[model samples]
Target: MSEETVRSAKGRMGSFSFEGESAEGLLRIGEVTKSTGLTARTLRYWEEIGLISPIDHIENRERRYSGKVLERIDVIRRLQEVLGLSLAEVKAVLEQEDRLLEVVSRYRKDLDSGTRLVMLTEAKRANDEIVKRLDDRLSEIGRFRMERVERGQRIDSAIEQILREAND
Candidate 1:
């Protein structure tokens, strides 16, 4: 198998780890930037904005990030790209990340135990039902409008014929 496939399999098996990849339980700023696919300047800017902070500093005085920082980066990316949250909103959410992760973890545990149904499935069903209803309503409205237009045309024809007879 390819190296990437082998790594994926190892990761799935929980044997592969990202620990110590960083500098002394903290990743170097460059490593974080590379791992996250974000630019170094962006990471620094985020730090300046108080959106993310490094966990430690090395002897060389370089910033280092912890595992939590990696998680935060992922959250930031998701909030911006998937949820369409603005930078300010993403920052606000990051402030509440711990609580959100706790809640999500509880729900995930419940789902794994089959105790709580996945809300996503229910939401999709409800959305499909609403779309079907809207389509039906639109079709009904179109048919009603067409009937009214036809009736008005018939009335106009009758009025024209009546006027013609009166004149004759």
Candidate 2:
């Protein structure tokens, strides 16, 4: 893959390149790597984590990505590199985006006419959903931490009893 610099307003350097014939829309992992500068492993890992999914697979089970998935990969890159999100955070964002898509589908008619009420309602719902997800994640992590602390305490108790018995 070859890249040429893209000049922007802030004079920051960005690169763009074309994958031969493959940028025609649907792309394999290698083509995506060539065009987006993401590795095949990263793509597979994203898929494994449910962040992005390929559109189809070929005979030998090679992944094929759609245009939408490519856009998702772009968003994932921005979330990780620019926003400094961990994989868990990025997963939450992706899940929220998925919910937004569902909300958009449900309110397709309102969105078509650019209705403000429907838009605000859907946005609020999306925000609430994200909050709920984050709260649940925090609770889950807390529970795991508590379990580990309890185990450590049990170990310390056993060690203390052993030392006391030996002394007695």
**Which predicted model would earn the best TM-score?**
2
Which lDDT tens digits does candidate 1 get at residues 8-65?
4334333222334523334567666766789989998998898898775545676756
lDDT of the candidates, in the order given: 0.64, 0.68
Error in Å for residue 85 of model 1: 0.7
Residues 1-168, candidate 2: write the lDDT tens digits. Answer: 222211121132123213332323455677667778888998888788889877665468667665567678778887778556689888887878787877766676554555756776887788787777657667877898899999999999999999999999
Cα displacement (Å) at residue 25, model 1: 3.3
Please give me the total number of clashing residue pairs in predicted model 1. 0
Model 2 regions lying over 4 Å from their true place: 1-24, 109-122, 128-168
| Candidate with best lDDT | 2
lDDT of 1 at 134: 44
